[model samples]
Target: MKHFFKIVYCIAILCIADTSYAQRKTAVKAKTTTVNAGLKLPTGFHASIIARDLGVARHMAVNSKGDIYVKMDRVKNSGGIIELSNPADNGIARKKTVFGEYGGTGIAIKNGYLYASSNSNIYRYKLNADEQVEDTGKAELIVSGLLDRGQHNSKSIALDNDGNIYVNIGAYSNSCQEHDRENGSKGMDPCPILDSAGGIWQFKADKQNQTYGDGVRYATGTRNVVGLDWNNEINSLFVMQHGRDQIGTMFPQFYEAKYADEIPAEEMFLVKKGMNFGWPYCYYDPMQNKKLLAPEYGGDGKQVGRCAEMEKPVVAFPAHMAPDGLLFYTGNMFPEKYKNGAFIAFHGSWNRNVTGQEGYFVAFVPFKDGKPSGKWEVFANGFAGVSKIESTGDAKYRPCGLAQAPDGSLYVSDDNKGNIWRITYKGK
Candidate 1:
């Protein structure tokens, strides 16, 4: 009889423990969402608006002081780099200051200096301790007269540890050719267009008087690299390449509607000095795990070798994830496993007839000793409106920029809704 009573008590205790565990939300579930914005979150991560009611914020950078520098591509009259700061870690942004009336598409901070780039030019702003733009008032125009015909004109900036500034001068055309957007077209032989753009350029970051033409070509054949960062571990530059689009309409035989929607992988590549990833001529297919020849350059779905001249990607994701920002987590605020992982902001896909629009969230790519371990998982979601993956007609905001606070928390920006949300890990 006594033995039977002990068994009952043990069973009751076990059930109670299980119930308690199931009732709690993980640290990832603390994500806060914006009002009127089509968004949702998974079970663990939490999100909250860092700064509300802003312009079409594209790219952003945060310094050690936790001040945010945002670049908005809005009406020229009301555009430029702005500084945002809060009094405390969890405090709302209490200050906003705008400097340099000129507008740009990119912003970054390196070695105590703030750099902002226009679609066709680059500029720098002086900053003060409070993280304010020095009201020094005037921004020095570093480079001007770049090829900015609207398409792929934004120049995201990254600085290598060796005092070199790497600017992404995206190709104006989707696929480089003599005539623009023509079907059955082939890439330019010798690809002379690479000399001016469609690649990254290394410039003397300390040189105060350098111009556009003064920089050297760092890497080429990158169609459009809006997201770039220096992998301090690898001691090399890494960039996420935005693959070309309209594969089926441009070349029907190789690219079916199904293939077009999910074939060419948006690639993350380590840029070795002078290495070329054959853009306009080839694309890396994540499904097949191979570098396949592009439809425009002519080849079957499984074709290869024509793009052999190009470099390979370190990691290949779905066709249109549209990675716009890349950051390696160097802070210790998160779990130990995430120490060296990479976080990417996928802006979401717009062109695919894909009934279910994908992306519009932040993802973490786990790394082991500087190399991606396995599959990348969604770190923080809810930007897209649908609760279930199959549900459509809900997505409203598209994620665009990513910034890390001094505490290792992440800030995601969206141009679709013009709001920024700060994400922090509260997991045990």
Candidate 2:
């Protein structure tokens, strides 16, 4: 009888463990199933979850045949790029292929080649007549030895019609301080880091094995640009610059803690060759609508100083929004108002502790004659799934990449869960 009782006890223990394990598995599945649960769209727009659990989906490109190639923020299972083929009319991808061994933030399809970037290198693969990559193993190295200090290390890429490829080499330090990110640290004179980084570099799109010396520093003094697009409409390049951080924490004498979150504006620039945007030495103040000298350079938070000579942003957004992807919408599926406009993906903010967090949504900037025609508006929202985001980790989804389909559908990728949302226009 004692042996039988012990056997019954063990059976009960096994049953409890099994039930607990099943509950845990179901919880994880529930999280993924809520991919587009709280996504909000504008009138005449609807969204669907085309892919999920894709492993840090970053910038993506859709080919002529509607195949999507997405770059992963990090390599998973030896694959960094994911290909989705044969998407159904219901917005579901019928086939998913994961390839490439390297990973970074930039990917684009131009001409007959598919271009992608690692943190320190740029590579291209020839596409077949079907617009699919011909050989995944033979990625040609177009640019190499770019700076990657791993602090603002995402290398976003944009290509021009003139066979030139532009890459952003982000500044590693916050403000080029003599002692990085330290309180009371003075700015480094001339900022040697800008010699190789803190700007956009241009290289030959078709050339192989090109290094820093082989490329031209197209523009200078941009702190870190993650979102950039070549405006074929205007024959120019546009970029969104992430402003500096911790003005109050680093220099409280000059800026109050409450004002730090709103002082430096995330700037949108009409980039021109040899133009200086002024980073480390200056930051844009949206309140004043002017570029102001950075605190490290001895400004009292309101002085323009040398920043008066820097190029001003065409549009300025609230500070710390973390713009990650930019796409010029030239699609016919949407209303005429959306044509030639710009869509930006804000990966959301992390450092806006005092003001709570903002910006887990995509914004649209109307363009006329290649310049912003009107004020920017939030095109998509509810990505955070919560009314208030006290911290970035509390958000359910962070919009990181933007792509437009051949049929004029807009695709937004979430880096948090690797979910891709396909948004289409459905006329009323």
Candidate 3:
């Protein structure tokens, strides 16, 4: 009888051990099934999918009441801007509403108003006390009649605290070439496109029915600026310009295919009034760390030439990364290292051949006293969810916009999948 009882006791001990092991395995599987499983973030950061299938979600803004407004790159489901509300504070949104008629890539919330942009116009809608759009039909045109000849036509916008709105008017030409991207094509000196486009224009934020004539050309010579922000810390405007393309195809004599793939660096600049960044005239060489005259403008890949006087970039990223969104981090939920730093959503490179496609992720540039202080690091990745992509269509998600919520969570939007991800840090 003593031996029988001892055998029974051993069996019980084994059962308990097996059950505990099984429970641990189940818990780990549950974590892996969460929305953030595909995302790779910092040590304490976690991401949750707040909404999906919202239709070509581009740039987005978060209101004080935690409502999300996203601009679509195209008119999907008969609308352009979509709003998400989550009164329960859960990761999932309870109500989704779509409004606005124009599709674009910019959206913002400033001073009791929600601002969005189409390819050719900037529109503003007044927000109610609950921070929702009062009426989509009452949307006022803050600025209209900007150029939108299709190539580089996104009129991304940013607003300042001083009642000013900044709009990007992209140049239609690739490099203002006389023949437009043709080999041996010469550039048009005094590029006529700069007269009305290729620059940032400042206008009144509250003024309605204003045209391009009413706004002042704030700065000149940017090729195209999709990523722009008013840095409240520095009390100035900063812009990221999409560099000119097709170096080898146009000027193979001076540039090999490999060199063309990585010659010009995408630039971010602290744009000031009347500043010239030398588009259609110069391109920054990341390896040389110097501005060289463009091939169409009489450069042989080594000549600084007339581009010597052009303003240099504050920080230059790798070529073809296609930065589409810029936000200065002011939230406290993140670690102290991220305060006042710049977060850039690199919409990813589509034309890479030599180094393969890159930049479908979000990067962080540490800032000290309103200036970039360290090397830029990839903060969020796996939007593409693949190790390598042969083309842009292979990417699962292309990050297009970024916004910080009032409660300090960060929101990222994807134009490819129309998904919005909310990232938060829960570390104590």
Candidate 4:
């Protein structure tokens, strides 16, 4: 009887252990499924959170080996860049390593090098054959002394195939006003701010310590450009300009407060050398489909004036959406329609006080032969996790950066919560 009792007890213990293991496995699976269903994607597409709480996660880059390097908006723990490795092939970053002393917006992986930028400087690190940064402590400064006023100082960067790197030096003033953002203040003629800011500067990729004098002003009149990418298909640079704010408050006599919520379309420019997109002097109005003279420059919102000579945007988005990241899709994991298309991460709006906040999603622009072939559509949303955003603080997550993995999957980084979401498409 005692032996039989012992046998029953041992079996009971084994069953309990087995049940616990099964429960744990089920819980993990459920969590994964829940996260995958978090974002609202189109048919056959899914998303899963790979990394979380990464400290102001901004722009990101993926190497050939699928290693992800994400730049932080601010430095933390003596490092700014986070390197994630997924060895389990489960689409989650199981191992994370943080390196780099300084922090800023732009980060890209190029030919055997990882390039990153601070607000005032750009740096690069050598990569090994495994496509990992060879020395995290040893970084080579490529570009330095770029403009960094307290406002609009994100030095977003992109690299072209010809060994040239482009950096956006955003204009500090809202519209180059004599007293910035003040009502009734006239815009400065010729915009002295344009001399040192409000444009894209091109510098040599391999040249170290190159300053503004060593770089060329590739294009001008851009208010601020946080989102930019090198389009290999067109062999040119493309950028999304964050249009100036306070259209109504600054010029209430010309623009109604309601109009401020709609006019001054965020512009997508196919940038070329010496091309100007008319910043403080003019702003594009999508409803009118024309570049209208800015009220700060003495026009009542309908005059084209000197704006006729300024280059127009290839595509214009809604105002105050804050386009932060741009990635031209060249991967094959998605449908053929997505090939060579552009994905833009709108970081959401804050000052749209009249109409509540908008944006906080990734938008897709279909491209054919290097131009937008069709209308832009919402690619991924629900980052805000709410039906409407009353204020920027009400949002749960803000999509800030975008990157494509080697396997053709898309990764988006959230600045609010520091969550990195990996988006993949399954066949329909």
Quantify all predictions' global Cα lDDT against the true fold: 0.76, 0.90, 0.88, 0.91
For each candidate, what TM-score against the reference? 0.85, 0.91, 0.90, 0.91
RMSD of each: 10.5, 4.8, 8.0, 8.4
Worst 10 residues of 3 by lDDT: 86-95
Lowest summed lDDT over 10 consecutive residues: which window, candidate 4?
A: 28-37
Residues 1-428 of candidate 2 have per-residue lDDT tens digits of 99999999999999999999999999867754553445777777877788888878899999999999999988887888999974646567754677788889999989999999999999999999999999888899999999899899989999999999999999999999999999888999799999999999999999999999999999999999999999999899999999988887777777777788786999999999999999989999888888998988988888888999999999999999999989999999999899999999998998885888889999999999998999999998877877899878889889999999999999999999998888888886
| Cα lDDT, model 1, residue 332 | 70
Clashing pairs in 1: 28-44, 28-45, 29-44, 29-45, 30-46, 31-45, 31-46, 31-47, 32-47, 40-382
Q: Weakest 10 consecutive residues, lDDT, candidate 1?
A: 27-36
The order of the candidates by lDDT, greatest first, is 4, 2, 3, 1
Candidate 1, overall lDDT?
0.76
- Position 225, candidate 1: lDDT: 87
What stretches of model 1 exceed 4 Å from their correct place? Answer: 1-44, 75-79, 87-90, 129-131, 387-394
Compare the candidates by lDDT and give the number of the best one: 4
Per-residue lDDT tens digits of candidate 1, residues 165-258?
8888888887776677887667676666676888888888777666667988888889898888887887888899998877766777666777
lDDT (10s digit) by residue, model 3, range 308-344: 8999999999898899999999999999999999999
Q: For candidate 4, lDDT tens digit of each residue in 225-317?
A: 999999999899999999999887777778778887887899999999999999989999898999999998987989999999999999999
Instruction: Report the CA-based lDDT of candidate 3 relative to the real structure.
Output: 0.88
Clash pairs detected, candidate 3: none
